[model samples]
Target: MAEAKAEFEVEFVGACPLWRGFEDQLAVALGAAAALEQKAGAVAVLLGDDERIAALNKSFRGKDGPTNVLSFPGPRVDPGFLGDIALAAETIAEEANSQGKSFEHHAAHLAVHGFLHLLGYDHDEPDKAEVMEARERAILASIGIADPYA
Candidate 1:
């Protein structure tokens, strides 16, 4: 049987508009990520700001502050639905600037990171983190982005 291509649906809620063509960027990122290449499903992406993401972080993960990205896995009722990934634009921009990375590259990395989480990849342990980071590096490289962990 042939593998199914993953789909992405993006919705901009707040400061996400700071970067134009974000949806296209996400499409390219997901397209280059091999993890999604053989998966049959749709991923929902919400582009928001720090405040919004912080609220989600608190409500779901019980975190106190804003994070760059958060991933919520969907139920298996519909196998075609992968899950939801939320992004904080302001937080991402700050991190990118501090880390000497382009906003686009940083955002792409976060998107891939969240997608990996949805696919059962976690970094709670050193071994697992190494594996996840390796996969992320390869995926970003395919799209001409440098190693995010470097």
Candidate 2:
């Protein structure tokens, strides 16, 4: 049998110059989770600096600090029209260092997390978290990354 097909377009906007080829990795990640399809719209993955992302975090999430990654599904929630995923480069790097994981690995995980959000996965509750994490683990494992929660 042939593998399922999925496509993604990723853009980095902040201080994250390390994720230039992340678009390709995202395709693999989504494909691994069986969460991809040849939809009619695009997925935007934006990466930027702490200040810019912090402002976004505060404005949208009601938090007053920079976060590692934030998903902006846009006003519309259709997966086909999936809008953007934002990552704070400074936050990601700092978190990765503190978490003892490579910048690339953590970055990859963030991308996966953002993609799941696009697919309507949220960790707002324990049961939801379990399902979401399982999906994340499968996706990451397919790409040769260890379980993010383990």
Candidate 3:
């Protein structure tokens, strides 16, 4: 039988012109990661600005600021509808510039990070963070992106 591949549906809203071809890049990055290869389903991605993300952060997470990415896991039923991920373009760009990493690489990392969350991965604790970060490093490396935590 053929392997199952996850599908990504991306929507752009509010100052996300800089991410014109990001959906393709994200698909490549996610494919390299192999996180969703065994599951046939869909993941929704939103590319928005700081203002939109900030509102979401505050409403959903009780935080009052914009973040790079946010993940919302789905019910995990048949056909595996994984979840949703949102990215803040401005914050990602700023973080990329500050970290000396290419914007594409950084954005890919964040996208992967959000995807992992939908797979029930979390980094709230040190041990969990270690595991999550390790997976992230390997995934990023598979796509020629350096260790994001390094």
Model 3 CA lDDT for position 116: 86
Q: Per-residue lDDT for 54-115 in model 2, tens only?
A: 89889998999888878877456455657678877778888889998877778888887887
Candidate number achieving the greatest lDDT relative to the actual structure: 1
* Candidate 1 lDDT over residue span 49-101, tens digit each: 88889999999989999999999888989777778889998999999999999
lDDT of each: 0.83, 0.72, 0.81
TM-score of 1: 0.88
Q: Using alpha carbons, what is the TM-score of model 3?
A: 0.86
Q: Rank the candidates by TM-score, best first.
A: 1, 3, 2
Number of the candidate with higher lDDT, 1 or 2? 1
Q: For residues 12-96, write the lDDT of model 3, one tens digit per residue.
A: 3445787787777887776665443354456777888888889999999999999999998877464456788899999999999
Model 1 spans > 4 angstroms off: 1-15, 34-37
- Looking at model 2, report the run of 10 residues with the lowest lDDT sum: 31-40
Runs in model 2 lying further than 4 Å from the true structure: 1-7, 12-40, 75-79
Candidate 1 lDDT trough over 10 residues, lowest sum: 5-14
Residue pairs in clash, model 3:
none
